[model samples]
Target chain A: MKLLELSGIGKRFGGLNALTDVSLHIGRGEIYGLIGPNGAGKTTLFNVITGLYQPDSGEFNFNGKRYRAAKPHVLAGAGIARTFQNIRLFANLTALENVMIGRHVRTRSGVMGSIMNSRAMRLEEKACRDKAGELLNLVGLKKPHQTLAKNLSYGEQRRLEIARALAMEPLLLALDEPAAGMNATETENLKELIEGIRNAGITVLLIEHDVKLIMGLCDRVAVLDYGRKIAEGVPDEVRNDPQVISAYLGVDGE
Target chain B: MPNAHEAGIFKRQRRRILLAAILLVLPFAVDGILGRGWLRIVDFAMLYIMLALGLNIVVGYAGLLDLGYIAFFAVGAYCYALSASPHLALAFPQLFPDGVHLSFLIVLPAAALLAGGMGVLLGAPTLKLRGDYLAIVTLGFGEIIRIFMNNLNAPVNLTNGPQGISRIDPISIAGLSLNATQRIFGITLPSVHLYFYLFLCFAGLVVFVSQRLEKSRIGRAWMAIREDEIAASAMGINTRNLKLLAFAMGAASGGISGTLFAGFQGFVSPESFSLMESVMVLCMVVLGGMGHIYGVILGGLLLALLPELLRHSVLPMQQALFGKTIIDPESLRMLLFGIALILVMLYRPAGLWPSRVRRRELSSDERPDETA
Candidate 1:
């Protein structure tokens, strides 16, 4: 079933059109990939979907609820979680603490509970910690309960970001360039982790530069160039499409 | 591992007991040895601790550098001043013929609620701004509040303006006044000593609340926002609401301290809530250790008492060296203070008692790149 539906999405940065008339339909438990050339508004579309940027003209429905100009946190509460293209971890906090922060939307405790040390607060705190620990382990982070996010290796940081997003218990997990800086083995592990996430009944939306990873992993693929969708189909169909070939492999390619 | 954990717990408890004993005896020890004037300084030190802890919630935990925190204190002070004193009687005799004399219990929450609401007012517009921009706005807020307090006398005479409000009622519990000496347990408790104990409880309560916040889920969310707002938001934190909550919580603490200050001094003045006072409180939070409660308390006590210690010693030392006082003591003390601040920043860039995160941040560059 379709979990997220966006129609005629358009975003502009001042005089420049970042994204135009973009439409996407993502189904539950499927790995959907968005691939594009530089400045094709891939990140902008990601930002719009995550509620970082308000789409100038468009509407989106997540889990059957329509939203307009939704704030990032509000979208987060609605079970949509995302990670940055360039990793944005809470560097000073422990890896476990980073995940615990993601549990904020799921948990409920206010200042009064914090001050009075209520029984409910104590129970919630323990549960939050336990959930965070499990997420860290799920992401294969070592010494994550004690080690700071900044101290972790690059690949580890990427995994930790995924873990943090997962801690939100999101219905849709949007990843921006998850395997950007990974070595071959790390990328392989990342692919497996993403598949595992999909298998566990969560929809995955990915923006990637790695065409091979996209072709190999995605159930469906969409290609964008010059702020417009050029072609969209399964990997085999998209790869042979003449418009995609022209935009991707031009007359005189880089 | 369990045995080791239990041993650690035992040691911590023992340390706490010893510290508690020292704290309980501190006012008496200072009174008997250094004099009663020193006890007054100690009492003010306790108040500063409360102020520093409040600011820490905003600056240290949430990473929102607020320079106008003293406005909340002023709000609290003025709230108590207007209600407890006879200023309102002269201004509006119809409403408060004998002056509105509210109990400490009632006025305390009232002041906190007022100041906290004001804090939300400040936080609302500035939520979109961060770093240096946020600081400049808050600085303006502090000055604006002070200017308002200075000018509110003409139209309605609500604040009594620059002259300030005096003869404010002392804090009383069930009818026992803190302003006067009372015989308790066969011991004569001076007014200053009584105030000291009350301030101690207030400071202790601030410390307790701060400690609880430091390790909680809310605290982690705050730190996450401090690290990166976008990431924090994506992590499902309501950044705007949390930032406002920080401001309100911090302001509430400031309000409580203000009520205590007005009660202890029996006076409220615009001069007491100056820009300089705000900066000094921020310094205590930063200089001691921004994120650590104990460090903030230590910073407050040191900064509060250091000037007094210098005032007492600097003159005598100058006189001894020159056979007459040569250099002005006030300027010399400030010069020493400036040098001390420079030295601390130079040697310990994080803070005197840096939190583990801060210490690691400062030292992170030493490790080789391991991203691969």
Candidate 2:
């Protein structure tokens, strides 16, 4: 069954038609890849899906329920979590604290409980901290949990962002250009991490410029150009299609 | 063997307990060894510490720059003064028909509520503006409150219109009045010592609550908003409500301190709540360390007490060196202060007592190397 389905999604920023008539289906536990050149509206599509921007026209269905996510927080609460193209971890907060913040949606203690330092509140805090530490460990960042996010190496910061999002325990994870700044070794490591997340029964929707990574990792690939989907199929068929080849390598085979 | 996490938590708790013990005993030692005058300085330092911690919630945690913080202090003072003073009978005879009314117990919480309500009022409109625009709007709001207090002399004469409110009553506990002539436990103590102890208690409470909040979910939300509002909102945190809560809570603390100030001084005026008061409080937060509660306490003590200490000693020391006071001590002191602040910003931008989080951020690979 389709876990996330976008039908006729359209978006406009003033006069700019950032995305138009985009439709895609993401199956449960499938790794869906979105690929396009610069300004292909890949990020725009992610923004609309993650509820950072409301699509001008579209119906989004999640878990067989027809609904529109109007705000990012609403989407997060609805079990949809995402990482940005540029790492946006809270710089002053420790890695554990950053992940703990992601656990806020799941936390039951309120302001009064915290102020009074109730026993239940202490237990909740301990659990959250423990869960955050586990996530850091899963991401191979256990030793650096107390280090500030900004203090980590570039690759570690990226992993920390993923750890923070995973703390939300989302059903579907959307990653925007996760491999954008990575070296070859880091890219290989990220491929394994993405596969591990998929194996853990979470669906993945990823936008990437690395066609090689996308083709290698995605169960299905959707190609976009000038705010429209130009091709959509299995990786083998999509890679061999004449239109896909021409669009990627250019019409004159430059 | 104990893991890193357990060891870290154990160490932190032990350090906190030790710190609390030192704070509690240090004041009494200073009073015993340094005398009453120095104790007065400590009292003032404690008061500023409370104000800085309050302001830290708004600016440091929530990332909202409030220039009208002193207005909440003014609101608190007025709330306490109106309820406890003989002037209440003159203004609102119907409310207090018997005479000047309200026990200290009632006035304290009332002052906090009144200031918190004002905070909501201020936050509601300015919430739409961000950055410099918000700062300007709050500055204007502050001036409006000050001007209203300055001009409202005729007809009702609520705030006394620059003549100020005086002869306010001291705090009374259960039937025991803490008046100037009152003796506590058979020992006759000066009013300054009484006030010093009161402020010390207030400061301790502020530190305790702020420390707790810093470790809680709300504190994390505030820090998230500070780090990235857009991302925080996306993380299922109600950014707007949380921001307002920070403002209200910060204002409430300011109100409590203002009540203590009014009771301690037995007088208050419009001039006391000015733009300079707001800037001084901001300096305390910035110089101490934004997110760190203890850093703010340090900032508060240094900024509030250093000037008074200099005023007393600098003149004599300069005379000894130059065979005459080189300058009118007040002007020279301010000049030195300005230069010192510039140097501090250049050399130690993270402040004297940066929070662990902020210290890491400032010292991380992303930042330039500096002693701060």
Candidate 3:
């Protein structure tokens, strides 16, 4: 079954059509790749999907329900989690606290319960903290749980962002340029991490400028140019597509 | 584990609990040993703490500069005065010919609600305006409220105009009144001591709520907004609602404190709720730390108490230095305050007690290099 589907998504910023008639689908537990040149509306699409921006015209179905223009927390509560290309972790929070914030949606304690430090709230907080620690461990962050997130290395910060999103217990995870600034070794580690996430039964949607990484990790690739999807298929088919080559690969090759 | 992290957390918690215990017991010791003057100062300091904590929600956590927070304070004071005083019948003779007065309990909530309503009214249009625009708008709103209070006395005698409201009744609880004649336990307590304990309780409640909110989802959303509104919005936080909530909640606190202030002093006037009062509260929040609850409380206490203490000491010292009290110590006190604020801004902009999050943000070097 389709885990996520977008139909007739259109977005505009002033006179600029950042995205128009962009539509895509991902099967359950599949790693779907979105590849486009800069200003090709990949991030804009991500923004619309994550509820940061309401599309001008579109219908999105996630987990078999028609998605509305919900707030980020509402989207998070609905089991959709995402990471930013620029790594937007809560810098002042500890690594564990950063991940724990993601767990806040699942927490049953209301404001009153938290203020009173009720038994259930305390138990839930402890559980959330444990889960946060586990996510940090999964991401191969060797630092103490109390270590501030902003003190981490570049690769670790990216990993921490993923861990934070994972703490929300997402059914589908969106990673935007997870390996943007990483070295080869870091990118390879990220590939392993992405594979592990997929192994844990979560569907993955990724946007990357790195063609090699996209080809290696994605099950299916969707190519976008000038705010429209031009081609989509398996990695080999996307690589061979003439339009994809002319618009994106041609510029990179020169 | 005997690790440094665990040790730090343990030590911090211990210190916090200890400090809270000391503050709780402080009123009793002051009443027993020092007398009413010391207790009066402490009461005033506690009131300032409540105001500071509220302002911190707007300025520190939510990153909205409010230069007219004292308007809410005035609202609270006036609300209490209007409700509790017999003069309500005198001023609004048409509204209540037989005279209408509410119990102190009702007045408290009424003040808070009225002030919160005003906050939303002010925030609705102004929330979209950022930075200096917000500051100026709030300043205008505050002055307008004060001027309106001053002028309203002419036609209707509502706020008693520039003369202000006086002889406002003290709070009463369960058959016992907190008037000058009230006694507690075995000791015959003055109203100042009664108010000192009452303000202490109110300050404690504010601190507790502020601390809890800072660690909750709402708190996180506010902090996120403060760090970067665009990014916070992208994270799915409703920035508009959160900003409004901050303003309303901060206004609510001001209202509560204003009620207490009117009851404690038995008077309300336009001069009492000035721009300088708003700046003083803002200084308390900024001087302590924006988001840190404990820091805000400490900031409030120090800022409120220091000037009063200086006024007491400086005049006597000036008398000794010049052989006559030629210089008014209040002016010198203000000069020292201005100098202190400048130093704090230049040397410790994050405040004397910075919030843990703010401290980490300032100290950490984790920004990804785009050039690299």
The DockQ figures for the candidates are 0.81, 0.45, 0.29
Candidate 1 residue pairs in backbone clash: none
TM-score: which candidate is best?
Answer: 1
How accurate locally, in lDDT, is each candidate? 0.90, 0.85, 0.84
Q: Give the per-residue lDDT of model 1 (tens digit) for B1-372.
A: 999999999999999999999988888999999999999988988888899999999999999999999999999999999888888987888989988899998999999999999999998999999999999999999889988988898778888888999999999877888888999999899999999888888788888888898888888888988999989988878899899999998999999999989988899889998998999999998889888887788889899999999889988997888889888878987798789888988998767998877787778758886757
How accurate locally is residue B260 in candidate 3, as Cα lDDT from 0 to 100?
93
How high is the lDDT of residue B333 in model 1? Answer: 70
TM-score of 1: 0.97
What's the C-alpha lDDT at position A206 in model 1?
A: 96
lDDT of 2 at B61: 84
lDDT of 3 by residue, B1-372 (tens): 569989999999999899878876777788778776888888888889999988988898788999999999999999988887777788667888745567878889889999989998898889678889999999999899999999997666888888898878878766667776576677666777677778877887877878787777677778777765655554456678888888988999999999999888888989998899998999899898877887898899899889888888888887888888876878887899999989988977789888766676676544653221
Candidate 1: regions farther than 4 A off: A252-254
- Considering TM-score, which of the candidate structures 1 and 3 is the better prediction for this target? 1
Cα distance off (Å), candidate 1, residue B80? 1.2
The docking category that best describes candidate 1 is high
Model 1 per-residue lDDT at A225: 89
| Consecutive 10-residue window with the lowest summed lDDT within model 3 chain B | B363-372
